[model samples]
Target chain A: MINYWIAGIYPRNAKLIESTRLYDKTLKEQFKKEKSRLLKIQSDNKLDFISDPLIDWDDNLRPFTNSLRGIERGPLTRYYENNTFYRQPIIKSKIGTSGNILKNSICFDLFNKKSKVKIDILDPFTFYDLSANEFYKSEEEAVNAFAGIIKKELISIKNNVKLIQFNAPSLARVVERDRLNMVKKAIENIVRGIDTKTCLNLWGSDISNTFEEFQEFPTDIIGIDFTSTRVDRFDKIKMKKGLACGLIDAKNTKMEKSADVIRELRNIKNVFNPESISITSSWDFEFIPESFADRKLQIMKQIKEKSKMMKL
Target chain B: MKKFPLATQEIGSIRKPRWLVKLLQDKNVSDEVKEEARSDVALLNLKLFEDIGLDVIYDGEARRVEMYEYSIRRIEGLQLAGKIRSWDNKYYNKGRCTKKVKYTGPYHVDEFLFVKENANRMIKLPITGAYTLADWSYNEAYKSKEDFTIDLARKVIRPLIKDLVKTGADFIQIDEPAATTHPDEMQLVVDSFNESIKGINAKFGIHICYSEDYSNMYPEVLEMKNHQYELEFANRDSWNKGINHSNRNGYESFLKTFREYGEKKEIGLGVLDVHVDEIESPELVRDRILYAVKMTDNPNLVHVNPDCGLRTRSRETSFAKLKNMVIGTEMAKKKLQL
Candidate 1:
């Protein structure tokens, strides 16, 4: 039977917003309060395994650019897409990570208590491609520079981390095979000698365009956005690493039927029955309202039960 | 007899009054009562425009909720299914089309007619463009984004434009803020726009602003049926303090595009910045307009306006900005000796 771990990229849903109770408190206070509440909710859910709650009450609005703003040399702008705006980190100078990059952002309150926790970070290529490169000479150099900085940060926290998923939607956008090679090099640099299981989550575009390049990634697990990408063609490819099949549409409020989700999972299991398989939303639940996200998770739990009954 | 050297107008929408906003927010107010209040507010906005002495004016969109939602709510074959983030801490109640899009009725016609009857001057009707209406919403039922966008143009936008034209609206501005979001699909945008305004007989224009990928806008955009391009240049004037376009990096590229291809089209130069709270000095607005005139190389084709809508700011800010815009246009007219 498949392990059937349920996970998500980020947990900043609308329900979290309504329940967080942020009135007059500073962003720091809100972050801590929201973090505690998120951990409690996740603990209550009692899933098999979980990822970081991304209790970014402080940095959720600007996530990547907020990290850069703390540093001396980060120029940022609004990233407009999907009815949401993220701060596009504009590289105005040599990129460097401040010690306070993810300090107050991460919630370790539920650490080592109930389930193994995963931390998600922006992939080196995504970090490079999404930004305005003023300092770096070339795209490759900027990616590598970003990779080196991220590598140092990961190496320090690799012991406690069960898995480190790199959000690499930018890789999916690349049409050229040569640029994919540069992304591969950058990924290899970031994960060099790390013990933690590395997962690469790609969304916002079809992954099949860069499937050949994705196969070359050094990560231990790969996530496919089955909602957006035609996972029907995926059976032909002989897969090796664990696969996280995104069966839920994160952007839509309507919940997928549990049986339909299970059927999709079964198709993926038949194709690349690798080390294990996990079910997840196509992207961040933040794209959806809280009630819908909660309903979607409920459907995921139902799908897990159905999958177990099928004994695939 | 002529007002100023170049025509001065608002892109669309003025700042909504706070008391009216409070009344709208009150759930106890009946829909009938709320609509009556909104009509009163619309009349107030129309009077305000005439008082400001704008060459072309709108009802400030006082009766509608922003641009996109108002249309979505009225259009058939659409449903508000989810909430999506528009920007930092701001989310729009978004929807999608599950069936073939059809015309529900004339959503903007009543609003347009009300303004037309009230305004003493020429009034332009601003409708959310087909591309933006489709682009901003999720595509649930459409076979392809291109097909869906075309459907929107033919079924939704074209009818609205025709109705507005039939109602004697002299100018109709299609707001396509999402046009350049996907640079690859700009061809689709242009094609769909042509389809929307296909048989509509009115002076049509396109309004685009705050798009991050404005640089990716291909020269082919000017090929649309629009006679004028109303864009926001003042919003991009963040780094500069004195309101001069010399410091704006965007101004140079925009100038190059207009000078190369804007000979046939009128350029509504946004001389006053709307994003900032600081009211621009008339001299600054004059300088920005003068700079835009010099860059475009066709002062006759250039017009003066604010960068974008003033709906987000206070009512006083909106009026003051328009006042400064008028004063500055007069200053530029003197300098140009027209």
Candidate 2:
């Protein structure tokens, strides 16, 4: 039986706020109550990774300070207001490298009673890519350490989770054709013993170089980004593993039609009928509005209906 | 004489005038402080241009931060996280920054606005492309860099470009120095540029530098289907005695691919090297421009500019380089008169 999967861009402030309100009651109580009701609607939709209802106190939410030795003062919060000389900090916590606030936000969503969908964590590679390296000596060391920590945490939460896909968006940055071999090797090392089924989310731009550089790996599935890279290039790549075709554009707020999505899938089906082909979002939909999330779910449902008709 | 507009890639020395440094520090300082800062750099930039005898000018990006640092401040929903060390020993922040669909402030345009108002000549507004912004930023918030880039193009950058075009700007240059980092990301960069320039009727130019590897250039050229053969012999395998076959192979098909990009936009061909401190002779610059002109069918669209910004070089070295470049352009224009 073909298993259908739905993926959207990772949740941002709106999703975080909703998840936080459900977990916290002190926000005027009314906003929290309203957020709970909204989350219930999301729960009824069978969305993946319910907003975690429990708030973790271990997460750090304080403004970044330069008290840490050897670390430069990160960009001021108002730096984004105009052109300035500050670099923003990569806030990570014991739970994750993205800092306490994001980790708590993700955790809050993960344990949210209303969320019934499978949970996928943003991969450690992307986090390490965003991390300030005054602490670590090299990218490999940072990634390995971060992955180890994530693996330990996943062990505790693996039972309730349906699937834990790792987002490796930074994989696109390795441009040296030969460096991809090292990347694949690194990925293999990080994911070697994890129990949960993992998917390596790769951007379309990375696929051309990746195919030329690292041909095959032991991962269960490979997520292809269709929105960023041209769909035509997929015809040239040869994959031995299952293909997670990202047919939906997760960045733009413009809603795509179910027919258009099915058309994109049909094009992929013609190229390679893998062991299993799952349709997903090209990237995270959080950059867009909350309504776009609803549109994404609707698109997933349409894909499911169309996939059922195809009987692949 | 060939009309080569004056431009500088990243230069090294940042010895700011004491008064200007003090003015940047004072928040309550009057418009006079800001104007003085703008004028001081404008005078320096204009002096460099005058000495070089070039038509177009820039204030050398003196009053701003690095491209990524400047943009990071304007994007909302992201916080200052921590720092990452670059290969050059500089520490950069590691945060979930996005060029995605939000605008906290005007960003580089505001900086350019000051430059344009202060400059005596038709100023060139340089903004980092969404692709570079997305490529360099942490993609944790979004699904992929492309997704983040497209969102950035559609939401933050496109709107900003439209606003920039409305500002009566003559030329808008999108700097894609990171184009060589990930060649596959070139299409997204192109798309973002196309989207950003959709409604604007301004003269658009792209500045790419330090892409000696040639691997990044091939994919982009092939994708765009442009035929321009302005190859840099210094970066060839012969330069290193034993040809690094991989680097050699990467550039083998570059000539055919470059032709494709040359067809669309005015190629601001980087005939002058930005990384090296050794000053190139005007004759060599003329030869490079002439070679580029011969390679592309439409030599008229070619504009001689630096390979990248001159912010990384010292004031004297950068001025000398610009002077040579202007002289070369003048000679090339004379030799290849339409």
Candidate 3:
């Protein structure tokens, strides 16, 4: 069971960050900084799993922004929460990767081998949806191209990674049935040749509508955000594989008590039993302050310890 | 009948001069050095507005960074939480409220006072709206998003408006680019917008854009005490491949919404596109304004401005755009015989 790993970017420790290097740092330096920060956070909390920290691609197009050339920066638009804004990458030319995207970041050692270091990639659907496609004829074409590109990257680094999580909030956001299938096909295309344990983390919309399809998804694990979706709906869907229960609230700063989290996980256990269960945040930890984020992780660790004693 | 037919206004935030941006970026500079640099450019920004013959002008938000973050740092009880991704890979330094938000005096008053003292023409104050600040921020103190927004409006925003109005601000424009981002939350925006302007003695207006559905805010938007609706149109214009050449007609969809719901209110028609580098000709601006006048069936109800703020554009482009807007409005005034 992989319990209590963080998903998405960890908030930066403000005391350690230099504002001048925000956009000036080289890719190698950024990776070193991220690993160091994650290691510090892990040691501080005594966490089991190594997290990628998502600090590497804080302001660049993740999983695809290999270089700064051939991409135009779109105007800053409001994120769903309205507090943060991302400048979307406009694909001005053919999208391709020149090298291994996650080589420098992932650490392989005795402690890291004992527990997998989690790395996140923007799912093909979201990459296509957020992009201004000037080259592709339609969004479907763009998705297909992106899937092939992502599949190549995944296969190249399949051994180095312990878990490959696809950030697919777009799949949950799609309303039309046909569009949903296209996104699913795109996901299927991206994960075709990968042997790493795969997890599809869906949020920002209800999962009940596509619960049956998600259960049959060709991946090792499935993550459902309990913050945005109702837990009662999960009773009807049976999990045949690993389940990543997003128990931590990502959007708000308020932390849930360990007892409350344990109770919720116990209730989830009463439903369809899976091969394994993992605990994580509902979404990105970047939404909250760093101190609060550390507290949230500590609460998750507490839940992990309490769950062990309870023996669900 | 109206104070000025085809009134020319420059939306808040002309681009920062390169030297000014450099001065702000340098850490070695003392506080006095940066303040001097800011004050000089602010006066220059105001002088540019006067030179271009703008009817209503602002100091271009010279003292601020962006719309939301600058005002947020000044308010009481809110703290910089962490950076969060808005989309793709772009991130912003976001904030969270630790306690009940309070008006910690005025943030933009000094900037406004400088503009008010210098500007020879009518000046309008542009402030980030309550709903936008609430919607963009992390809500920790309130149980519901609506509750947080309402408290922000009543406590932080209303008092700011009251202060600005008390300081002889005749016109106040609240910029809410995040207004219609969520269709369901438009009610929160409308209700809180009304709450923000309550008991304020000034001619109020709202700026909403980059949203597809302005209609959702309407009927409820009509309920607000504001007088003008400044919306982006030139950015959405479809190009017409005419017999001779091509031209941009941004107001094609502009009239469709205004005709249905904007019968009683004034419209600040955006005739220039700030997202692009192509300077709009006076003829194109005149054509867009004419289209608005024809479609809305009221020439007096239309005021001319850019689609959005010029913060993204170069100073040269912004100045030329504003100059063309004034000239185009003059042409429209002559043509309409208003």
Q: Name the best candidate (by TM-score).
A: 1
Model 2 interface Cα RMSD in Å:
14.9
- Indicate whether candidate 1 or candidate 2 has the larger TM-score: 1
Q: What is the TM-score of candidate 1? A: 0.88
Worst 10 residues of 2 chain A by lDDT: A76-85
| Two-way DockQ contest, 1 vs 2, winner | 1
Each prediction's DockQ against the real complex: 0.38, 0.02, 0.32
DockQ of candidate 3 relative to the true structure: 0.32
Instruction: Please give, for residues A1-312, the per-residue lDDT of candidate 3 as tens digits.
Output: 446677877765553244423444464565566667666667566565566675655542544554524457655444443445556667787777654665543444313455556677778887777766777778888888778777877777777777888877777677677776777787787777676788888866678778677776777888888887777776544579888888899877777988988888877766747777888888878777677888888887778777777776
Candidate topping DockQ: 1
Please report, as a value between 0 and 1, the fraction of native contacts recovered by candidate 2: 0.00
TM-scores of chain B alone in all candidate structures, in the order given: 0.93, 0.77, 0.93
- How far residue A224's Cα lies from its native spot in candidate 3, in Å, is 1.4
For all candidates in order, the CA lDDT equals: 0.73, 0.54, 0.75
lDDT (Cα, tens digit) per residue for candidate 3, span B21-101: 888999999999999899999999888888889988988889988787887899887877765554434345677877889
Better-scoring candidate (lDDT), 2 or 3: 3
| Residue pairs of candidate 3 with colliding backbone atoms | A82-B136, A83-B136, B237-B250
